[model samples]
Target chain A: MSKSVRKKPAAPKKPVAPRKPAAGKKPVAAKKAAAVKAAGMAKQPDIAPLLTVSDIHTYYGDSHVLQGVSLDVKPGECVALLGRNGAGKTTTLRSIVSLTPVRRGHVGFDGLDITHSPTHRIIREGIGYVPEDRGIFSSLSVREHLDIALWAAKKPPERRDEVLKIFPRISERLEHFGQQLSGGEQQMLSIARALLAEPRLLILDEPSEGLAPIIVDEVRDTLARVKKTGTSILLVEQNVAMALALADRVVVLSQGMVQFTGTPAELEAQPDVKDTYLGIA
Target chain B: MTFFLFNLLNGLQLSMLIFLMAIGLTVIFGLMDILNLAHGAFYMAGAYFGYVVFQATGSFWIALAIAPLLPLVLGFLLQYFVLQPLIDRGRSAHLDMALLTFGLLFFTIGLIDLVFFETLGLTFMSIDKPAGLGSYVNIGTFYPSYRLFIIAVGLLVALIVWLLLERTVVGAVVRAGVDDREMVRAMGVNVYVVFASVFALGCGLAGLAGVIAGAELSINITMGVQILIPTLVVVVLGGLGSVKGCFFGSLIVGMTETLSQAYVPALALFATYLILAAMLVFRPQGFFGRTPKSV
Candidate 1:
């Protein structure tokens, strides 16, 4: 089944094969770390994961999705979760925010175990999510979107100018409703709304979807600026090149499980992982 | 011309009353997606409660101020404690909830029949206009001051609702919630609180409309079911979940009913149904509702 390789939107800069695990899984090491933290409860070392999801099993009714999936994001590191549609990338993100209830396993955020908390409560603990649909409120104006995000978060509009500066075009369209904006502008508004919450971890689900090439570059640039500010990003993208370009580490999903975890060069190296899991030929 | 002006005022007065009832119905349907058949019960309860308050205090103003609170508290408890949990727990589908409200409607009428008629030995009752609004004002013809006051209250409420939905931060949250409930929650807003607030506010308005209507017309045991038809017609004609649609829909229905009944007494509601049918045929989404997407 030689299908066409899904081309990269961003130039494939450091393409590599997948890193094979000749090594043990992370549970034993994670257990050791958890035990140490519980014993000493010392201040986190620089390497302590900011968002740690360990062996999470989620289901939609009887249909099992996200089977025993686990991953982590360290401080200021961008981890891209890549997969084909139905690979449960979105569910993984939803699980992190507790939007989709996890049937099994643990999700540690910063230090607290937040696996069973409500979506709103999980979000209030500092997670910003921009969903796949862009999640724009068609009746609300751009300014209203920004204001409502802050209002919901119960935070002052302190990041308004600073975040809006990254999205200059959105600043100009403050009065326009979500339906009136073009696709690129809507995506820009979506990202800007998330950034205004002053989240330490910003999770975006395919912000590049449905945008023109030039607009994708614009988004990429804005995201690059956001990443430079030391905000960790957990991005899910069908746009493999775009995800790889920004990601310090990549997790590839195939049939609700992690197929590979490596640097972009490592993902580009293993053509078989890209071919089998990512549907790249 | 005087006769025509008379129908016009009557139409306008009816429109304002329907608007008051329809606004509450629209937001609750829009926010909660609960097709609450019991909404008209709130209007009926409002009139009864207003009558009780008026009897106790001998002040129309006091009745107007206090009557809506009972329905408000009742609606809040119904939604916050009962309806929402059923939906959230996945125990009741929307159809189930709608059926539950239909059951609630019957239950309320039974209680109203028992308390207001059988027990209290009340006949078809009406509240007198307050001293301030007792006299008629000359507007083309002699229009009753109280009717004019209903129109004023209706417009004032419309303005206030518009401001709350469009200008305030809470309104923005509501508008956003209407579009995407889950997204609003993901943004860290507890939408249940918002839903419960809108439910309380909507029921309160219905109660207020009932009290106002009681002053103008006779309030009877069957008033709840009688008003339910017009209110439902207005809600459907305007489109579910839109305040603007409710206002305009109310005007259209109110005017059509009053004018047609006055002139074409034989037609009854043939003309109003014609317009509603035409609306259903040409633009099924109503004035402000989005066109339903095909499955």
Candidate 2:
């Protein structure tokens, strides 16, 4: 009993501090609202920003994973959260979904303060989580996986049709168990399962991890098609080239702090930013 | 030949009784990951309550109905009030829960032992053999009507449980939960509610089994131990989480125990354990159940 309780101290500390505000200015909720209003400014863009995670500090125990991370995506925008390994990229996505239990700053989704809401409540509020590990129910089949996800998400029937269209790989193997799928196929199923939820905000953590190069390209294409339908996506990927080509905006973190945030063009011109943080010359 | 037929019928009834105990145990262990040793105590409580209610009202029917329902409510309260707090604290280990339940088991059984020492062996005082069907019926051999009723009731209950689990939306959620409870919670079905409901259902079934078994075998405080070991063996043999597996495992254990008792009385003492050992060697996870899993 003491052991389980003792192991959780580091996990709880990160979530509570993040539940407040980072660096003590305004609460994260206020900053998130301000970010969304700033996003709504016509001079910036016309697309409605569905989620804004701004100036957030997140930690896993004493390890500061996401430092001062800020990113936003419009209702139909696809923003890639890109960085090298240990760049706090996945932690940024986790903070936005309230999975990692953020320490500082706030996340606003669809203009609601969801920084402290439970993960289930957040998902119900139209945010879907696809973890880096795929988190598939191995015992259940493809059809059963979708069935549970859809049951939980309570999406309209049309969304299932759209999901099947997005990932035809799963349509052919609905009865196959999740564990039976190959790496690429499992990745596809993970994305497909999340898509069936019809979330307004889809936060995917390292979707391309552990996949063959060809399969990675197929996943990228699938994400692109999904973006075309006006679903806002926050994609965390180490594959920088694909992200640069796909994202409307890019946010990079170095040592748990935001080093750069800009469009693909601005990021391309900053060689020092790339070399110092990404180890890319 | 007559002796063989008689033992076969008795074995079938015993298997059914044990299946009721196991189905609940397996589901609770598989999905909630909680080790419950006091489940037999709950079964005993049902028999005690049934015994009292039958004596007071002299209505076997009311006692049977109230017996299971009382235990179901007790289980729900225990899970909600007691287990939930421990689970919230992350201190609800299998060893801890088993120890806690052991205390409860001893308390409940002791209370019953004190209350009705003489009436402990009473069996189905309210239910009588149907007048026309009381005599033995020959189907290549003769068997009592009451014994056949027990078999028929067990099969019907098993079928209902299977249909409900396989062909319902709730069943889909439950199946998913057994594999990945944390994910199920993240997916937004108040997991506590599901857990409590399943716990109650499992306990309710146990109590119902007690009521049914009371109709077949004599009820006593001693019945708990007699049923528990074999029931657990059946669950392990069937597969930890498979309802269908439990059904088949019960049959195997039942037949083996019955035959061993009749044909080889000397081996009867170790018969159930022998079958369990053989099954463990061949299929450690049980006949229809999957391998011991970590969700």
Candidate 3:
């Protein structure tokens, strides 16, 4: 070994894949993790699955969307929901939060059925939703947004400091109105506001839709960091590379049905699935 | 000069009474976005209910306590059976709902008119003067103590309302909901409950204002439209849903109306319309109201 090996200032980027496990279903996840290790990565933590949505039907007035969507997210794991445009992915997220009127089936989060509960009640039951459009009050400043969020949720006052740590950008833009921020800044504030709610599960719909690649990478990194802090995530993303790299498990929805659910290795191996669905062949 | 002081006191009392009436109207309009022309009917109901109570038990105090409750209960039932459905189905239009409430107003007013004649009925009813202060006081000139009390109470209520809106979370949500109902509802708040509660509260305030007016002045069927127009002006002038704005607007309207009647005899004929015209020319959205944001 060299006497003075130059140490990098930041953590090294480890390879994201391992080895293909034994053929014919020896726990799809184990094989996937093995593939991740074979590609040169340490063993990640095994988190419990926190949410299980099954055959959920949602509609918007007369529009029949979210036909029979089903997915699960393990506790402290980042689960990415990928789909094509108008594949009812956003409707699935909204239905889970009880913002959209549900027609049938169940959404179980933290071992409680919340398919029929009101949005505010769902919020109180510990699920934070960052909507696709980023619903921030244009007139409210960053500080005021946090103040109103906590007050409305009847949450304790001290989470404000904890929120600032994750979103130092919001702390910096404390006096800026929601409308005053750039697109990337508003996205950061929206995610930060949701995190301040201190939910066990955070459902973010299309967080990387319009941001620059660098900003998208920052969001991807933040999700990874927050997952480490024990907040499980249900992420919906259009960026295939970001989804595959960051998610512990990937669930693909096509026309409101789960088309494929597996780890990134299986998805990478299935070239046909990638080519047909995402145009990524 | 003594006559001027008397008129000033009279004006203050009238403003305070109108403030009570307009608070309910503005709250329902601003928060719920429901046009309720029948709000004036609540005032009429209070006057009639107070008269009935005053007749039943020769006690003005009991009438004061019981009179407002009847109209409040009536408002709740009306909302539940009538207005709520209209608002829920997205059928709320200014002219349509205005006509609906106006019909209810006429029906209620006519019912009372039939029962108690066109003239002020129940001759035994008289407000007991606040003792010690008597009817008049000389503060350099002369003032009515009862009218002064009424003005004090009105200002106190307005201050309390301002505190509720500025300091409390529920009030903050109400104000936000007023500007943007969909935004508030999308944030997981049940704006329907907020609307119902605010409607009841506004109508309740109107009823109480009616009882006070009935005691202070004469109660008649014709009082509804005549008083309603001025109160609407006050609400608009103060900026809808802004208590501070309403307070200052009320004082301005009150002082102008009072002074014009006393000092300028010829001007009194066109005084209310004159103020309305000037305000329209200067500030169409009222003095304190901000320009509404595009949805």
Each candidate's DockQ: 0.41, 0.33, 0.18
Task: Give a tens-digit lDDT track for model 3, residues A73-143.
Answer: 76666788887898888888888887676798777765566777767777766677777877666655667
What DockQ would candidate 3 receive versus the native complex? Answer: 0.18
Model 2's DockQ score: 0.33
Q: lDDT tens string, model 2, B1-295?
A: 8888889998898788888888888888877877667788878877767766766776666877888988898888888789877976667778888788878878877777776664454332333333554577887688877778778878987888787677665676677777766566666566677778888988888888877666556777777767878887887788866889889888988888988999999998898898889888998877776543312
Candidate 3 accuracy as lDDT: 0.72
The local lDDT score (0 to 100) that residue B127 gets in candidate 3 is 46
In model 3, the runs with Cα more than 4 Å from the true position are A1-59, A65-74, A82-87, A104-113, A138-144, A168-189, A208-219, A237-245, A249-281, B1-12, B49-107, B110-129, B132-134, B139-141, B182-193, B248-295
The true-versus-predicted C-alpha distance at residue A127 of model 1, in Å, is: 0.8
TM-score of each: 0.89, 0.81, 0.74
How many backbone overlaps does candidate 2 show? 8
lDDT of 3 at A172: 92
Best-performing candidate as measured by TM-score: 1
Candidate 3 lDDT score at position A270:
71
Regions of candidate 1 where Cα sits further than 4 Å from its true position: A1-46, B291-295
Q: All models: lDDT?
A: 0.82, 0.73, 0.72
